[model samples]
Target: MTATTLAPATTEVLIQLRPADEWLAVCPLSRLTPGRGVAALLPDGRQVALFLDRDGVPYAIDNRDPFTGAQVLARGLVGSAAGRPFVASPLLKQRFDLSTGRCLDDESVAVTAYEVRAA
Candidate 1:
């Protein structure tokens, strides 16, 4: 395996509420497994669920499930609907748009979506 070079992350963005700065290198791109979601604990103790597709495209959202109030979104099933990537809540089976964090089952309830990119 070859090692890739990246600019040092001098300052970490404290995302108390949601992620910020599109260029923020939160983690190594290689850490994520395709078609699976992983939980990343932010500096503020907030847990964010990050999903990667087979193509290595990344999506991030709150790890909590609104219906059950459980922090298990990271273990949800990943799929796509109408060309939009979504993650189905493991507890309620509610589909959440990974790009926007909109709940397909309930429009009023939504989670925080974060912008992610390969470093």
Candidate 2:
């Protein structure tokens, strides 16, 4: 699946063996609680964090926090800012946009936002 990441020209596809339309299924929709997140490992060993908002909207992003390089985004707090959903990094408290994966505090940097869906 296609994901929006920093530097699209240099972005790498981690799950190569799977078909383009398929992504590693993290969990069932019912298993994801609101205001929380879950982490799933890709075939390439990279972890992707999946978040479902209180309103039942799903979002996916790289689990590693760019600032501290720790795999902890799934433990972040979920909330909304100005009607836009976001998650606060549990370590440094940096807020990230759920739909875009853009760090709200620093616009220059961002994590990868995966293409996800609930079936």
Candidate 3:
């Protein structure tokens, strides 16, 4: 669930999640359309929302609504401020950074964001 850049000399670049000891792939990168999002359940039984920005960079966050504990972050609306992409909480209209998952409304909490790349 961490995002990191990798480089290998003369090798084709591929962005992908670090393989877990018992990991599963839920959705392919092709399923995400720019400026749109898709919700999927992980193999670990967690729900997550995956988004692609206007630049086609992928981001993933927990789908759970922190304010209401509802599984609605995936249904939340997406927008930008200045140049940062954020997702609004569907229940309370709070915004969170898509890259870091930091709650814009409350600095005390943050959701998990997974590292996403073209793979």
Predicted model with the maximum lDDT: 1
Clashes of each: 0, 0, 0
| lDDT values for all models | 0.83, 0.81, 0.79
Residue-level lDDT tens digits of model 1 in 30-107? 667888888888876788998888876788899999899999999999999999999999998999999999998899
**Please, what are the lDDT tens digits per residue for candidate 2 over residues 11-50?**
3323221214665555667667888998877767888788
TM-score of each: 0.79, 0.79, 0.77
lDDT for model 3 comes to 0.79
By the TM-score metric, which is better: model 2 or model 3? 2
Taking all chains together, the TM-score of candidate 3 against the true structure is 0.77
Which digits, one per residue and each the tens of the lDDT, describe model 3 over residues 1-119?
Answer: 99998786664433354335433455666677777678887767888888888888878889998889998887778899778899998789999899898998899989988876665
